[model samples]
Target chain A: MNLVLRAACVYMALLFVFRVAGKRSLVTVTTFDFLLLLIISECTQQALLGQDYSVTGAIILVGTLVSLELGLSWLKCRSTRFERWLDGTPLVIIEDGRILRERLAWLSVDEEDILEAAHVQHGLLRLDQIRYAIVERNGAIAIIPWREGG
Target chain B: MVEIKRAGDLETSEDLAFERTSRRVRRVARSLLYVFVLLAALGLFGDGPLSHARAGHESGFFVRYERFARVDGTTRFQIHPHPGSSAAPRRLFVSTSLFERGHVEQFVPEPASVEIAADRSIITFPRVESGGFVVLVMRPLRPGALRFSLGEEGGPTLDLALFVYP
Candidate 1:
């Protein structure tokens, strides 16, 4: 029961923080980000497990975490709004070679970032070469190149 | 970027979209595994929060300590004896490389005298009543493995090892 409570709290806390931190934080990974992640996990483990290091305690913690995740996934699949809230709806940042500066600013994305993704993802060489640019749920910028004939 | 005019349908590509999300999840899982490996290597799961080893005598009077600790932090060391009044307080010499002897603090019940020395601290328990135990609170002076024993080095039954983090 304690394990379940701890897991639930940690899950909600992480969800809230990631949502508040926005998608860009998770999408962009630096060397320091990896180290920060490890530190956070270490602290979380201490809070979750307390001083109980038995095999049973370990099983309980794992069980609680997996169960909570499965429940959230089930909820997400059933409710579109819940899914949107859990994973923000993707935003279309560019359309027909026109940059949506407002939406791009909202996500703190830049023209350079978009161009970089465009070239790497779809061989788009310039802003005018892109037909559509969307910010995907996972935080990566997606580019749709202009049709050759169109 | 390769595209067709949304054709009046602006919905994202279902297949590629799903792949992107799954790839992200896979990356996250990999990162979690990496951290887990690090924690396991540090023996944190065994000695830190998940430690289930209680303070009890298996062969001789022993102490189970955190093999790893942080400098300037405190850890509890519990002691359980052989259910009787040992009139003579046990004279134990503590030798540690990881902890500063002057900075080491102790908290125990009555009838225990701790003598701080240059290389060791003598912890003597004077006829502790039944059900009474000794609890020592020690602070690390440096970051390394602090080794000590209740008696002579290598021959002491109550030997302990603590690693301090800087």
Candidate 2:
């Protein structure tokens, strides 16, 4: 197989995958999303550069994977219940300067990570200064400072 | 004092209008003056030949070849690499006597090495790699206005000459 033709096929496959993966995949890199990214790159490499690779075989496999992703994204976008099932909602890990240990454990986030993110993003150095903290859907920590007036 | 407390006259609407217009004109004049100063500075010091030379040097080496006036003697050529690019180490290749009309010559680097004399009168390069610019340095085997087609891959090519230096 010619190098240029193989390269073009791999490029098209990647484009199709990205389009089907939905906006959330780009916005956030969850553990699952990261795994998908690695797998996709590996698969494309096999198709483009590997000796035993067949362009038609690679295209078929990539097309099927993309179709599945598109179907899931469509379902998740249309139904709130389905979206919740596929993409879990954010959980509040802290409220009114009190840590919610249960929610933190559920999200697999440690207190140190939350504190560091808080200090970095909002300049909230002390735990007592944080009024609210939430683990956003993208796995990022958001911290709200306690109101001075309050 | 009561008799002296007379009425004070305020400026008319026309006067207020004139004052506003004068203020606007003054603002516009100031802005235009700033623009004129900027353009004058640019014209005096910006986009001149010196700046262009500096820019070309900063971007990459400049290579020029003059026509060969006399034949059968070695001519000196010098190439100074672009400012930040001197560290990469480059090569110079040459195919002489290529000006014979309708005669095509294939000259590949023998063993491919890149090292030139301190005076830059010699040409050499290392083993071929995937990328990098090649500067073709021609020393005519025989001189009498020789023209050669020369360029490196991914770089500009031109037909030029090296005249015999008196």
Candidate 3:
């Protein structure tokens, strides 16, 4: 088996597992999520590269991983619930021109990081200008500006 | 009644547009699937030996020495010969920016002479003895690839590979 194909297989398996585990599994990657990722990678490494430890084994493993990722993406497009579950629904971190400090801390993010992301995305220089801020599932922060009329 | 009829017609057109968009997306998805399958098939069944051979060929003539201890303000080259080659002394000429401040030294049974030119960047070693399997430490000033030539000018060339360890 090619390394990529093996890697693809492992990746697809992981994606399927995550999808089955529900939206929360991917929504907030806690310490548990990190551990799962590490373990999966370790297992996949052995399966892809094999115990032989040769360059050929390594290539086949990588191929498997790529194939798996492609397959999962295809599946994700066909299912909205699966997409939401794996990718997570974006969480509103700031509302009504007020910072949701609790949610930020919960996501293991700092004020500086959110501020920088907001500034880069929306030219939001101050927290007061932001009507709503969302912590996206893909580990990104988005800020919506306060409307002038309302 | 005419307004109602117009609304129905607009609804039908919107539905048609959605259907067309969906069809285009599905077509793109199918094409992508075919490409992925083709790549997988190629990786599995096509020219496996050829790929390995190519990797091996590329690995030749390139020596990589990584993460060796760096002495204060000195760059070093650690040359290790490929497996199963005869151990013999070969002349070497190194041309690189690495020797900007320092000089090259070879550690063998015999004492070797190192001559740095007036430019201070270029160093010439006439003959450096290699005692079978041993590491030669050369301290060059700069940190980069140092090209080494292994024989006298217009003389029969010998097989010697150069590697830098920083």
Candidate 4:
């Protein structure tokens, strides 16, 4: 009982914290972000296990966390409102070579980030060469280049 | 309402209203987080100014303990026994509930002997003068309200309560 409750609480807390942190923070992982992830998992491990060192305790914790994740996913699939709230809808930040400065500021994204994604994904050099740039729900930028005929 | 239109021949779906509302909600959430951190720092969570507490009586019996403690986190409980005019060793009676719920890690000025009774544990201390104290380093095993009592045998008993956080 304690094991399941601990796992559930930890899962809910992590979900709220990461949601508040915004998706862009995790989109690009820096060296410090990787270290931070390691530290968080270390702290979570102690809380989940408490003093129970037996293999059964570890198995129970793992099962509890996995079950919680499956339940949340199922709930998300059933309700579009929940899916939208849990995973934010994609926003178009750039259209027809014009940038939406306000949306970029709100998302903590900049022109350089869009251009970098463009460069890596499409090898495009200038903003004029792109028709649209969208910030996807997973925080990755999707770029559409102008038609060759145009 | 959402608007679906073509951007350079590729269809796009955008909900400007939802985006605006979500941005506002995130702003509020960040502001609340700052307040939460401030409260935790003020000892509302534990181990801060509000957590330190003391209880005792005028009979020279006193105890220092934490009003709020964390499960599995070590905390100190100091007991001061009144050294009367007579120079005889003192015996302390502690409720068994304390031992049952708290794991004693160490004891200062170790008791000469511990005799367990049905409801309480009697700890005998060596003869001492005034200003002598016994310290119990304990880690609470469970979370929630922990109630216990301690005092010298045939003397005043001080009841202590601690709220343990998980």
Best by lDDT: 4
**What DockQ does candidate 3 have relative to the true complex?**
0.03
Total clashing pairs for each candidate:
5, 10, 23, 0
CAPRI classification of candidate 1:
incorrect
Across residues A13-57, which tens digit of lDDT does each residue of candidate 1 receive? 778667656677867688999999999999888867765788999
Candidate 2 segments whose C-alpha is farther than 4 A from its true place: A1-52, B1-166
Native-to-model Cα distance after best TM-score fit, residue B98 in candidate 2, in Å: 66
- Could you give candidate 3's per-residue lDDT for residues A1-150 as a string of tens digits? 344544665566665554334323454467987998898778766655643588766666555556666775786788755554455445566766667677665455666766777788877787677776666556566667777775
Q: Name model 1 segments beyond 4 Å from true.
A: B1-9, B12-166
Write down the lDDT of every candidate, Cα atoms only: 0.66, 0.48, 0.46, 0.84
- In the order shown, the candidates' Cα RMSDs to the true structure are 14.8, 27.4, 19.8, 2.6
TM-score against truth, every candidate: 0.52, 0.33, 0.34, 0.90
10 residues in a row with least lDDT, candidate 4 chain A: A79-88
lDDT digits (tens) for residues B2-33 of candidate 2: 01111122111112233234345445655766
DockQ of each: 0.04, 0.01, 0.03, 0.42
Ten contiguous residues with the weakest lDDT in model 2 chain A: A16-25
Candidate 2 clashes between residue pairs 3 or more apart in a chain or in different chains: B66-B161, B68-B163, B71-B143, B72-B143, B112-B126, B113-B125, B113-B126, B114-B124, B114-B125, B114-B126
lDDT of 3 by residue, B117-165 (tens): 4422222332333322233455543333344433222333223222322
